[model samples]
Target chain A: MKSKPTACFLLTVVLSCVLVAEGNRDVNQEDRTIEWWTLSTGAGEHDPRTDLNRLIAGEFHEQHPHVNIEITPLHVEDFKKRIQIVVQADSPPDLFQSWGGYVMFEFARQNKLRDITYFVNSTLSKLISRESLAVYSYAGKFYGAPYDMGAVVVWYNRKIFEHAGVPVPQTWQDLLYAVRRIKDAGYVPIAMGGKDRWPAHFWWVYLAMRLGGKEAFDTAYGGTGSFTDPAFIQAGRLFKDLVATGPFQEGFENATYDQQAGLMGDGIAAMELMGQWAPSVAKNNATTGKGLPHLDVFPFPSVEGGKGDINDVMGGGNGYIVGKNAPDETLEFLEYFLSEGVQRRLIEDQGIIPVNKAAARGQTGPIATITGLITKATYYQLYYDQYFPFSVGEALNDASLLLLTGEYTPEETAAAINAAWREFK
Target chain B: MENIKTLYSVKKLGLILLLIGPAFALFTTFVVMPVFQGAYYSLFDWKGIGPLNDFVGVKNFVRLFGHEPFRTAIVNNLKVVLFSLLFQLPTAFFFALLIGRQKFPGAIVFRSFYFFPYVLTEIIAGVIWRFIYNPQFGFLTQLSGLIGPEKTEIAMLGNPETAFNAIFVVIFWKYIGFHMILYIAGLQGVPKDLEDAAVIDGASPLEVIWHVIIPSIRNTIMISVFLSVIGSFNVFDIVWAMGQGGPDHSTETLVTYLYNFGYKRFAFGYGSAVAIVIFFLCLVFNVLYQKYIVGDSRS
Candidate 1:
């Protein structure tokens, strides 16, 4: 009888201890763990960006000793596909890398993303540029924050241009003349990666922007106009005219972006229509290990009868979005991650064009020029592949390539895009 | 005895169920369920997320048949099939005959050498071939330079007329060894005494091979053909790793078409419709092949 009573008392004590442990664990788990998914900026195991991200996470965890962050780093290409599946499964990471535009809008529409407007207004709004911030906003609500904003500009090798005896073009006709001069000098005038499709489509999108500006896109996106607008068709026609010049390197249609960058880096091609990252990519892919010593940037020249201003820019930025079930600390973490000091460090280390206003002051060379153009832009248009609905954007890429290959006329290309737009819309 | 028989039968029933239950369940879950689910999704206009509310009803299918890229994809798949049947299989058979029963010097080494490509993963093989086909710094460019000073390079994969053929070359190189191995196995099974008897009875080597060896390997050839046809239609990874179905949708097979148009574009409904179409194509071919070929041979 005495033994039974002793056993019951011991059981009660052990059970209470277990319950208390469980209670503490629940509270700690709720406050502590955060899951983050990101794309590595370089190859696996050797990526410095992955180390930087981990260091940032480590520092943030040190500041808040109760928190633990689990980071999942994936390759750039695989990240896009994996995130989509995870988002669809309703269990997305607390935060993941995003290229802010229609992809974010799609997620926002499905309520897969958390609205961070309050956090943005309180902290991020003052630190980051409104133009850059707008990239992460959808339906009048902010869903994320940007770290890097870059414009697509014409990057040219100064030596190549000098050899060809052609000055930097200020008009479309001048560019065409330079192309011919460069070609005559026995070098590829342009290095185009048509196999990827997006690089080639940039030509059409920039042309469309030059021809019609923001109004045309707005009207078409607003459903009052169609993609078969004269401006879009004319853009295709202009691109075809450029294609007919045979300015791009031989087999350019099958070249990847890396191959295109290699040609420019090796001085085999005189110019490439690329973004701020082009120089770095060229340096990495170049045969000499160091690309062209003297590089220059020029804005896309104005067309003869175009309504759009030459100052209007086409670009995008890399950012991170908060998942629907993310903890409130995710916002705090983002703020810390994009702090002025961190942004400067990123710019100094990684050659990223910082979106932070204070960090933007430190940019030099081609990056500074791109930053200036973006800041002074009368309008900023994101890449069409990211700006429009997925189907329409893909159709634009496909049709644009078809137009380049002489398989489809400008009218037929416009018709294809418009047909896809109608279906998706 | 009757009671014992009933007990044994009950035990047998339990054992059979126990053995087959897991496999049956797995097949139903992974294979059968997805087919039915894909068919169901084909009726709706879903972007692969949220509720499937947009019930368009045969609209995706109607649009798929009318879509230009899809038609191009079908033609490309047929081209692959034709190439494999006409070129790949015959080459594989010829090589198999040369080395199958013969004990030539380096025959073992040659067998391993030919089968080396078959052992490589498709993606790796595709990447290797891509480097070879590259115009700027590729082997072909150097070869062309050596041949002519001005004719510096040839971009076989860049041209629409040649991209699919380039991919076909890789496919043929990768899979011909597998078919050759199959033929070798069939040849090994052919009774050596039958060939000897034929030769002794005044039949020539070619006549003996035609009469004795070919008839014995008919079943293996039939299976290889069926596999090759299905494989041709389903090729995606190689083409994707090389060009992703373009310079301008020039190298698109049905599977790549389904991926680029449906999944990449986020039109899951249309993608599911494409999946159904592919399934039906395979099913029809399988049924026809089995009925006319395998079944006839068996009878």
Candidate 2:
């Protein structure tokens, strides 16, 4: 009887200890975990994004002490598809990157996006611009935080222009002159990638901005009026003329983005009329040639008879968004991310454009150049396709590809756009 | 006595149900249901999202007919099917017979070499051919340099003229081995005495092959041809990897066009309509093939 009592007493003590240990583990599990999914490109056997993610995670963890952020950086091409698949299935990352306009609009319409209006109104309004917030708004509600913004700007290879003895084109006429001059000098004036359908939208957006002005673009894309305006027709003609000059590399319609980037990087092309994010892509690809230092930007040269001005910016926002179904701790983490310190770190270290205007101007070095551009912008043309309805946007993207490939004449392209708009509406 | 008979019948019925129950359920859930859903979705216009699905009847199919490129994709698919029937299946069968009858040193090694490409994933095969077809840095281009610039400019898969043939070449090289193995298995079933008797009758090698060998493996050839035809029509990876039907979309096949319309363009309704057409075509061809070509053959 004495031995049985002693054994029971020991067993009770062991059980109590086990319960205590389990309780501690539960608390630690809640405290130490964070989850994030990002669309990180260029990840191969040893992706740079992996190291970057680890470093950011390490630093964040060090500051938080009791937190660990789980990061999954997916391949670039697969990013949108994977995210859509996951998020639509009611399982979403704590934080993800989504572009402004229709891309966010679709997610918002599905009620898949978190309304960050309360967050913005309460604490974020003072830091982030209302303009930036307005771009992320859909049906009068903010769906995401602004992370980066860029206008579609022409980036030129200085060496190529200089070798061709063609001056940098300041006006619309000068651009045509440069194109002809560069072509005569035996260097391709422009290296446009038609293989990547998304990139083909450049000519469309540029022409839209040039002909219709920012407001006309906004009205057309917002599904207000007919897209078959004479201005759009004129823009199409200009695009055809540009194509007629044969400024692009031989068989450029078949060339991939990387091939075009390679040509521009090697000084084989005088100019690349693309978005501001192109500088980073160009810089990364630079090897035997001096990269960004030898590169400079300008807004698309003003169409002489067009209403658009030189300062009118054309670009879209690429930024991070929090999930509506994310855990409470994730919201807290996002709050921390929006803090000035983190925003500053993002701009300074990562070269990522911060959504906060304060963060933008305060940033230094290469990021400052982007900041300068943002500060100087008098008007911004949001990426038109993203602002348009899904079907309309898709049709426009198709029309752009068709236009470049000579599958449709300029008039037909304009007609197609209007037809698509009518059908979609 | 009636009870006993009924009990026996019930037991037999139960056994019958038990044998087919799982298989029927599996087919119903996986294949039949999805196909039904696909057919249903084809009638409606939806982005595969939101609460909205607008029923537009056969308008999507009408629109497809109106589109020229889609018609081209269907033609391309037919071309691929024809290429497989005319070239890959026959070539593979002939080689399989030759290898099966011969007794060479390291014959197994030679067979393994032939089957090596068949083991590779489609993506890997595509990448390998893509490298070979590279205009600037490809091995073929380098070899062509030894010949001349005119040959180098052939742009095998890049040019519209040669793209389909180039793709067919890759398909043949990769899948011929699979059919070869099939033929080899069938060749083993051919009675050696029949061939020996033919030889004893003063029949030539070609005659023996024609009268005995060919007839013996008729079933295998039919099956292989059917598989090759289906596979060729369904191919998307090679064309996608090579140039995504570029240089003016000349190389597009049905599957690739369907993928482009559905995924890239987000035209799910039109994409589904395309898929339904492909499905019906495959069904008709399969039925016709089995009835007229395959079932009639006796070996």
Q: Please report the candidate that would top DockQ against the real structure.
A: 1
* Candidate 1 C-alpha lDDT tens digits along A1-425: 88998999999999999999999988866666779998787577978888888999999999877777899999887897898899989888988998887778888988999998988888998998788898899989999988888899999989989999999999888988999999999999999988988888889889988998888888877889877899999998888888889998878778899999989888889899998889889999898989677888999999988989999999987899999999888888898899888888888777788888888886789888998998988798888888888888899888888888899999998898888888777
Number of the top-ranking candidate, with lDDT as the measure: 1
TM-scores, all models, native as reference = 0.93, 0.84
Clashing pairs in 2: A102-A386, A152-A314
Residue B280 of model 1, lDDT score: 98
DockQ of 1: 0.56
Model 1, B224-278: lDDT tens digits are: 9999999988998899998999978888889999999899988999999999999
Off by over 4 Å in 2: A1-36, A42-79, A82-95, A110-112, A180-188, A222-224, A266-270, A279-293, A325-335, A362-369, B1-20, B97-100, B105-110, B139-144, B149-162, B199-205
Clashes in model 1: which pairs? none
Candidates, DockQ: 0.56, 0.21
Model number 2 iRMSD: 3.4
